[model samples]
Target: MGYLTCKFVRPDKQLFEGKCASMTLVTYSGELGVLPGHASEICALGDGVVRIKRLDEDGGDERDVVVSGGYAEICNDVVVIIADHARAADDIDAETVRRTHDKAQAKRDALPEGDHQRAYYENKMAWCDLLLEKAGAQTASE
Candidate 1:
């Protein structure tokens, strides 16, 4: 295995650069793991947690980020994540997360019966859930 360069970008073009031995991304279809030498591919990432195992320079470095939604691409020796919204674990605000979750729940309740609305709420709920989880809020919605 070799070091994999990871770059996560937000819609505003903010970038978070790091290195990881491996990474796992959650998509609407399923989860995909990337390792060194993996085949080139693109993934439509849904709202969920994007876990990255950063290479520790001293002894150990730990970090995690919650992506609202995005697309991920793996090619050559780099993993590129283009996220519609993203926030680091430490950067998430509790009040805002709660409000967002509440809004998603409201939309879910108002949504009509169909796979499209169901999937939409599901994804929104997923984003709020991940945000609350990463933010250390205890009463996050499932």
Candidate 2:
């Protein structure tokens, strides 16, 4: 199989740039897998993981990135992810995420159901929850 050039980036830094055998991206619609010579397309991204598998022996290790908010593009055997925020799986801080989740939860709980402001808090908590889950843990209470 051929390799696909992949680039996963955030505003702050480029998380990854190289060739990979394949990758699976979690998007608003769901997980989408891309391989070399895949059809060109673009999709809305969401809060989830990106798994990139390297195929060449000389290349570096595969990577799993957690990203939120942005878009992914595939064209001409290249995959590009321009995320609003992203971090390598190994870099996620579970404790920080738990704390953020607690804060958002508190704000969300203070509001009645269907409150517009509550939606923001709920989304924050959801993102935090996703991060903590990927970090292999959960809220202190759990």
Q: State the C-alpha lDDT per candidate.
A: 0.77, 0.85
Candidate 2 positional error at 12, Å = 3.4
Per-residue accuracy of model 1 over 72-117 as CA lDDT, tens digit each:
9999969999998788776778788788778878887887777477
| Model 2 misplacement above 4 A | 59-61, 107-117, 137-142
**Which candidate achieves the best TM-score against the true structure?**
2
What is the number of backbone collisions in each predicted candidate, taken in the order shown?
0, 0
Worst 10 residues of 1 by lDDT: 133-142
Model 1: which residue pairs collide? none
RMSD (Å) per prediction: 4.9, 4.1
